[model samples]
Target: MSHSSPASSASAAPASIACTSLDYVWPDGTTVFDGLQVSFGPGRSGLVGVNGSGKSTLLKLIAGELRPSGGTVRVTGEIGYLPQNVTLDTALRVEDVLGIAGTRAALHAIEAGDVREEHFAAVGDDWDVEERATAALAGLGLGHVGLDRTTGELSGGESVLLRLAALLMRRPDILLLDEPTNNLDLYARRRLYAAVEAWNGVMVVVSHDRELLERVDQIADLRGGEVAWYGGGFSAYEEALAVEQEAAERMVRVAESDLRKQKRELSDAHVKLARRKRYGQKMWDNKREPKVVMGERKRQAQVSAGKHRIMHEEKLAEARERLDKAAEAVRDDDEIRVDLPHTAVPPGRSVLTLRELRLRHGARVDGEFELRGPERIALVGRNGAGKTTLLRTLAGELDAVSGTADVHVPLRFLPQRLDLLDDELTVVGNVARFAPEATPNEIRARLARFLFRGARAGQRAGTLSGGERFRATLAALMLAEPAPQLLLLDEPTNNLDLASVRQLTTALESYEGALIVASHDLRFLESVGVTRWLRLDGGLRDTTAEEVRAEMAGEG
Candidate 1:
């Protein structure tokens, strides 16, 4: 599914990181990893798992950001880590973020004929530090950015890359990147992929981006507090998982059948023993043999019956254990399901139109454009290109600066903020607010498909995790009254794990409506069945998926 080539990380004999009998527990007594053992060698490894399966937690432990509750992490050299949510002082310059401000300052002092012992020491072996810094930034598509530029001036995506550029500058023996492509545009992601391919040291990336995963040398799937290694990239890992799941399912079926047979055999043995007891009693009453002989025979029969029952019971217990083990091998990754038939639009129905539209954010759509039928449009652009502003205008949340925007059908907008739900309300209560006509039972039933089953549906919105909050907000939007025929989603896949992204796609699959989704994730767009590609640079222009791919490749 990825257009990018596999990242062939330069082979090197780098230091390895080993976590022996690692154990970590939260202050609230929630255990994340207990006696977990894993190791990473020099190469690019894609660390993957379902949301909250401790992918990020494990990375933090490796980076020494979090300490294990009971075990030790042994590393051979320095480690560079780019966390998922990167926050830096806006006042800091680009050089500061790259960790070369002091070196550069020292080099400048020496060049200015003001060299002192401290200055010379500071400039040790880093006389070309500035040059290397600029080249590293350039390699990551940050060449045009001045080292003196303030961090606040860069967009969200740029900030992420700048941080990575800093890590690259350090040249650590091990590098850890968490969701590196979360906010990156096509160009930045391509550059990041290039950097990943060029890395010769130990590297482990925790990302849901399929393209990023596809470039890795191998995959380390962390689930249930353990790591499972798969050679090759994301595609190979998926194929292997499919085969494994199939075998696990077959074992489950066999186990169940064996359990049933054991139970039946046990029941038959009980019936036979009861019949023998009755026959022995009849013989005793009829005086068919001496009292002593009848008593001895009865005693022997009871002893044999007890042993027979014990054997069958043990077999049944063993079968039950097998069934449990088999079931554990099968994954229960949750998926979102919806039936929005009412949201469907006819092929000839008009959906959305923009006429000489000019958004308040300074992005303009030239002339007139109309969306007909249930077209799935992928709105793509660089950061700060006003994709979100366009979606806001479509959703009627923002008045256009000029021109007119009209929606010809019921519509819903899911913004990147995900602030639609009220924290005071429970999951079911929030959905009920959106669909007042829907009964409480109906709402609960639908929420189950969103993976909020039973008590989970009763959980307050404020208590939801990142993935859960996204699902709750999405449920409220898609299940609203007068069902949305035109959905405008801005960066829907951002911050979502791979499973949640698939869940979003699953929900979209059931939505028979027009969709305009703004996202930088290529695989996600393809998964959601995007029919049209709209690139919003200075102007909203029509493009193709292949063209987008070509741009990413061509620019690279």
Candidate 2:
């Protein structure tokens, strides 16, 4: 295939951006990027990778927030960036927030004085700015919220949604977003996905949400400081990765076999050399005698030649040993294994039973509800609907000022914030601390089951990404032998990527224990087979999943 010239390619590519031989280094001497090259055009692209694998860094480079230490990053048109955490100035009202952005554009227009009416028309007519902002907010489920509401009053999920609204209103030539779905509830996430599908410009989203990634046309997997672009969605990328890992394993096996064969040959050669040296020594000693010395001269010459051959063989054997060591090192460094342990716990007859449970904080009332379970229940509601509060109360972490609560079983809780873990310890140490009775080998074995093996197990818990830390916590829980009969989880899928979430779902499906989880991830709730829905307000109400879904749809 013929390649286009750089100038032509830049001109012809639609909303294209490129980074050539990019390199970035931290002040602490960590090399985050080295000779990175990536390009994107008009299409849906997903940046998928493990945490701290430079996905966000690469996005920053593309957005021009961070300059490359070496190489060039070029964007042909406007770029909009949605960071993972958007902290809007609290003093500004929602209208003022968008107006400020519009004013900047108007200023740029005025300064240029070359602005056409079409420029303003693109943003809005005389009142176009307001119209555009309203439409954007509506698209993101924030339409019902007043434009005069202070950003400070918004929840984390709401703030994120507003930021997304602002980005959509801007409508840059290329969109760069980091974890756009992180704070969005299921309704909002689905809305965002639909909006992206309808967007005309090139989009590059960095997210761990598998449902979102599955919609992308391509996936750029950042692994080991390099980007590997796969031409299909998450499933295709997974299949390709499986193939690549298999190939790596095959190489390791072949290399090990070769090393073993080389070692054996070297051993045989050493034996032969020792035997030859002994024969030469005996011949030399015998030939040194006076009377037979003349006749033994030929024998002596033969022995001398044999000694030289043995010495050469010894040199070859030494080189073989060095080669074997190198091969062994390569095999050892191939890949890190993740082995997670299965800690299955049986459920009690009545793991959790709530009778006329009413959750209220002063004036706010959630629900007057009742429930009994050995069943998996999903607690879901809007951003501030008290789902989390209800779970906390049920877990006995929160003091219930009213209502009767009954728990007939042991429980383990995995909070959204991971409060269960000590951030200061290593992965292994954290597991050991949690389950002190477990032996070192047993701990390592359990961690390996959770995909924390080798050096990963030794990594500080504080240094681990959200997903890794969660997995470590799960591993620790599994070491409990008789696992907790009841599990209460709060937004369990918050920071987990698509793959990890799927794995977790698979494990939970097979679990025979009772569970009460609060989350906004519809896909996850559906996958884990939630048998009942508990809707939260000022109090808890027993509702079907369908009803909750309808309520959310109406909100949209």
Candidate 3:
């Protein structure tokens, strides 16, 4: 919630990063960006798009981790990038993780009078590197973490902050962060938000964290193989997009009207031309004019009709083009729809009962609680607070240290790793594996509702992007035989893009079964209509979203 400012922004001239006529295609021939021209200058810009939309890939290309197949990517200053998955070596010391181990070692040797010229060279111009590293860690809310401690001792959230601190210590003119808050808790997320707000250089962050996006100076929306810029934060971008969508829809209606009018006019012209030809034929029958004159008149009439036909057809084609362009401007973000009436549990039926449950980590859930009907519970807690362990214990994946977790109905657990589906199997095949009694056609039809239609359903799970894989995994779980009446989801939104998160929320809306979702995303938890909020902190306690956010805000 609070942080001291880092040293001033990069003293170098404001960095400019741009992609010129960029093109990238996967080996399998899936084109992500084609002739995409985008430029970003100094300021915090949040890059957002649907999963599989190449947000991360763009960042990688800009950071020089990946090269474009065609075109030039230009960057002006030093760049530091923090990727979506931050994997720190557990054996490495904190200073090593910060990339200051050599400097610290040199300083120590100099203090101990080693009198080595190499030590003096290594310590050059970094006499205060230790203090700067400490300040960076403290700014990220890891003040208590000692530089000598091993990264293995840090929690998941702490590790993310530590990685971020390492990036900040470099003071890069251009900083690229991709989903930096993926593993962070609410507290750590706030710390990240503060750090983002305090950034003073060219910051390009690709994140689905709404709070973090709210602090950006602008939004670069990468969609449909192009980028659209909005001059403001997330909320502002939404407002601007909503206005654009409304205008686009209105244009579509107008274009449709004009197209219909053109069709009618063309039909009328045809009728009039037919009447004139008949009249001319009747006149010729009566010998009202010379034969040669009649023939000339007929030729002129044909030429006029030809011109009219061409003009009307051109008008219709232009109208159609306008309608198509208008329609393209309006986004069609279809959501996943599912129906599971069979999974419903009656109010009198008990879904889950945890009795004096003690987890492997010594956290005692010494409380008696029963979930009945279709009650949706949100399991919230700080990192290492036993949420995952509790979910695993309830799912029967792990044995509890003591007590019992009784499930009176068929249950399915969608773990954070989403390992339920076989990677080698097709999406339809995977779902069919879970529901052997179902016909192949039936499985394919169900997969369509999960947005894997036609050949998409037949693609191997191993080839699916992260979000698509999640959808397939969820489909397999929900479509499993016996139908899960009680579902346990652990960190469902951890790696999902915002659109995928919305899709998950929509799919859950149709689920009539009891649900327990362990998550750190308060917005997602609230969106799923959570009826009960339970905090797992060595004990199970009923809580509310407001209370949770208050604690995150340092108000509780």
Q: What TM-score number comes out for model 3?
A: 0.90
lDDT of 2 by residue, 84-118 (tens): 65778888788765655555466458558947776
Best by lDDT: 1
Q: What is the C-alpha RMSD of each candidate to the true structure, in Å?
A: 5.7, 7.7, 4.7
Q: How many clashes does each candidate structure show, in the order listed?
A: 0, 15, 0
Worst 10 residues of 1 by lDDT: 1-10
Residue 179, candidate 3: Cα error in Å is 1.7
TM-scores for all candidates?
A: 0.86, 0.68, 0.90
Error at 289, model 1, angstroms:
1.4
**Pick by TM-score: 1 or 3, better one:** 3
- True-vs-predicted CA distance for residue 248, candidate 1, Å: 2.2
Q: Give the residue spans of candidate 1 off by over 4 A.
A: 1-14, 27-29, 105-124, 338-341, 346-351, 359-362, 393-410, 417-447, 453-466, 479-483
Question: For residues 1-556, what per-residue lDDT tens digits would candidate 1 score against the true structure?
Answer: 0111112342233467888888987654668888888999889999998776788888888887887887767776678999976778999999999888888888888889996999989888888888898899899988989999999777678889999999988888889999898778888888999899999989999988888889999999998999999999999999999999999999999999999999999999999999988998899999999888988998999899999999999999999999999999999987666555467789989988889998865799999999999899999888768887788888888899999998999898888767888988889999999999999998888888888898789878875655677788888986787878898887778667777777678778878889999888887889889989999988999999988877777642
**Candidate 3 lDDT over residue span 1-556, tens digit each:** 1111222453445677878888988765778888889998989999998877888888878887777888878777788899876778899999998999999999999999897999999999999999999999988879989999999877667788898899899888888998888767787788888888888989999988888889999999999889999998999999999999999999999999998999999889889989998998899899988899999998998999899889988998998998898888888986566554467788878888889988886666786878889999999887667787888898989999889889999998988767787888888888988888989888888888878888889888876766777788888877788888898998888667777787778778878889999888888999999999999887999999999989888786
Checking candidate 3 for backbone clashes, the offending pairs are none
Q: Which has the higher lDDT value, candidate number 1 or candidate number 2?
A: 1
